[model samples]
Target: MTDGQITLTGIRAHANHGVLASERELGQTFSVDVSLDVDMDTVCDDLTHAVNYALVAQRVLDVLMGEPVNLIETLAGRIADAVLAISPRISSVQVTVHKPHAPVGVALDDVAVTCRKDAE
Candidate 1:
């Protein structure tokens, strides 16, 4: 970030996704939030240079809907890999996977998993 620019946040996705016998059999949605740190100067100049939230969301949805995974952790990893593949300009990425209906035998709002990847 430079001048008056701060970290740009893309679109946040909320879906009930999970990995459990009951949850998967019944089907669930997973909510995902991605925070990316980018250079505003290049982004502000050209829209193409900026991170496209729609594309990012769609990429994540593709992974979630593509195959049936047994773990949200795996899903998070896949999301991170795909996002990095799509946009190389990204300096760092933070992905959070939220499972609202977990089978904990107790009332819980959601369980989340987060992963971060920085440029190498």
Candidate 2:
């Protein structure tokens, strides 16, 4: 494994993911951050030898908008799985799901869930 990582941060999307009925009715903005451990030792002079971050972002967005989940934990897991499926060269992946407009009735900055997975 090479000591290199590709990070995609601040990916904003609108999704209905929460326990409250209002949350599912009126979707809110969500932010996603992903980091993939990749092998930088590979010989490359083109994008083919590296992970396409645009495709990675789209994969995350696809899962975010695909279905409604009640918890950010589940969403985080799905994102990790999706990224891990992208390529075998990816040794590990970390995914974070941010919920800024939580209905906790408390004044808070944001709530988020992070998940990490390693290739088997």
Question: Which candidate number would show the highest TM-score if scored against the true structure?
Answer: 2
Candidate 1: lDDT over CA atoms?
0.68
Native RMSD of candidate 1 (Å): 3.5
Candidates in order, TM-scores: namely: 0.78, 0.94
Error of 1 at 108 (Å): 1.1
Residue range 1-120, candidate 2, lDDT tens digits: 367999999888899999999999999999999999988655666777778889999999999987989999999999899989998778899999999999888999999999999988
Q: How much lDDT does candidate 2 score?
A: 0.90
Residue ranges of candidate 2 with Cα displaced over 4 Å: none
Which whole-number lDDT from 0 to 100 does residue 51 have in model 1?
A: 68
- Runs of candidate 1 exceeding 4 Å displacement: 1-19, 42-44
What TM-score number comes out for model 2?
0.94
Q: Which ten residues in a row have the lowest lDDT in candidate 1?
A: 3-12
How do the residues 47-80 of candidate 1 rate in per-residue lDDT, one tens digit apiece? 6866676787788778767677777788888887
